[model samples]
Target: MTIQNRERFLNNVAQHLGRERKTKNVERPSSSLMPQWQVFQHHSQDELADELELQCHSIHTTCKRTNAENLHTVLQETIEELKGQRIIASDDSRNETFGISSLYEDLQKKGITCHIWNSADGQYNLDYAESADVGITFSDITLAESGTVTLFNNSGNGRAISLLPRSYIAIIPKSTLVPRMTQAAKHIHEAEQEGHGVASCVSFITGPSNSADIEMNLIVGVHGPVEVTYILVENR
Candidate 1:
């Protein structure tokens, strides 16, 4: 109100503005969760697969490397290891894809009940995946740096296959492996440009669901799959 008081108020405002500008801290380097740095690519396919396996183990996920030709054998072994008699799988139209439609035949021969998810089946697939000993799906993008698999939910590619089952097995082809997240993003973006419909839900799963929130106690499989396994195929 007074001249001197007004001058003091203006000075106080100026000081407050200066302090606000000074409060910003230096930006830190990119982290694993939302990395900003370039993803490191493997020198060879073998190197990439090895790196992915090691990283997956570090995160408590089981990972195995196998050839496309022997993927069926490897998959059977994995299912046997889990004592899984009932399995749910995603159906891939491409015969060469890891989620090939004929996998049903092989599982059936082994006396393992396998259900291939279909949009027409709707809730039946969800219910099957929920109680199935394990659920199988293929990944669109695989990140070796973080051992992460990205699954796009669609009418055919049900999210329940990967999210509802107690054990999840993702089949990833070596060609899908990218050194970093940016490369994977670029690939997905390009695919979208060429008429690939981006789905409503995209899930990037690193490992089994875990939380350490309550009293800093460790808990696993609270929200999603209790265990996760990755099968990296060379010819996928």
Candidate 2:
């Protein structure tokens, strides 16, 4: 942001608060009780994965386990189960690392259309996502406590890849698994401190879109994907 815009934003905030904008930065208070740092801190990776699976049931999401070697086969099977015809996937390097690059070719051989997100395509990306039967992405971070997947969206992996498709699939590596959002935030903050920066859009998706009406009738797939499947890849 420009200096003038930054000052304008602060002025607007100060006016709303009925106080003048302070020139100096204020030091934050620290608490002695830090439970967030302790919850599930001792749990092993395997234990975290188990917790993720257990929470998935409550969130109305399907959880699948696989290894790096079988990821391609398992993913293909999952696409078939979802009856996906036209697929849209993020152009994430981790996909190639986990043996997914060849699967796209195999899918094409079977006449399944797979469109990888391309920045050069511009509007065509959104157009493809709208008609896509399934959208696939690799989770940057997996929260076991809430069965949530964190997507650090970028030019190559746009938010539409996850929000516009009928069905969604997230491939999570074992190393990205964390106890919850606490650890995820910490990782991002530390990365920024180390000059690694962060994605402009970080999406935390738990499960398929759902809502309840005034009558308390629960509706699924109201605003997003009708179904979501999380594939946890071990030893990735």
Candidate 3:
């Protein structure tokens, strides 16, 4: 929208909600003038998990669920299936917080060249994430309704790590799974309130990158990963 139109709209909304319109460029909290109806409710853990996998599979993406203890094994198997020589991985603290800190070491032991993404701190030695065959990262939240995984961009989390690779692997903890996008957004906002700070770049990725031409010919990985895998850690 045009700046003038947006400002006028915002002022109207603010006045209707008994709020003062902002005169600066700062973001203002949106008010709910009209009462919100009960539109969505939380789903059971089992339901969310099932729905997430179903949605992912429908789009040709693979979602694997395994016990937390067997995560290392499942991760290794996924890499083996890809048979890629070079892999780029995230060094996000969530890896250790979820109890799988040796992922990088494991990759190195397997003779696969591994690069840790540290773009936030200017450690861009690995350059663009597109050069790697597979990119690995952790998910802070997963929305079951659309089978989407949320990636927070920071020093350790790079957007390209998930989008530029031929294949993307995400380690998702079950506790972070939500029934829909609204709940996922609430969780991210709450986390930010507790000091996670809003992610500068929050991505909701569903399956891999795909596009169809006017001729109806489908092309995968034209702009992003051809294959996306979600390894759900059930015990978490």
TM-score each candidate: 0.78, 0.89, 0.79
Per-residue alpha-carbon lDDT of model 1 for 44-127, expressed as tens digits? 667767778889867789988888888888888888898888888876664345545566687788798988888898789988
**lDDT (tens digit, per residue) of candidate 2 on 75-111:** 9999999999999999988877898989998999999
Q: How do the residues 45-124 of candidate 3 rate in per-residue lDDT, one tens digit apiece?
A: 77778888888877778989898788888888898898767888887876776666686677788788888776554636
Using TM-score as the yardstick, the better of models 2 and 3 is 2
Error of 3 at 210 (Å): 0.5
Clashing pairs in 1: none
lDDT for position 13 in model 3: 94
* Candidate 2 C-alpha error for residue 71, in Å: 0.6
**Per-residue error (Å), model 2, residue 51:** 0.6
Worst 10 residues of 2 by lDDT: 1-10
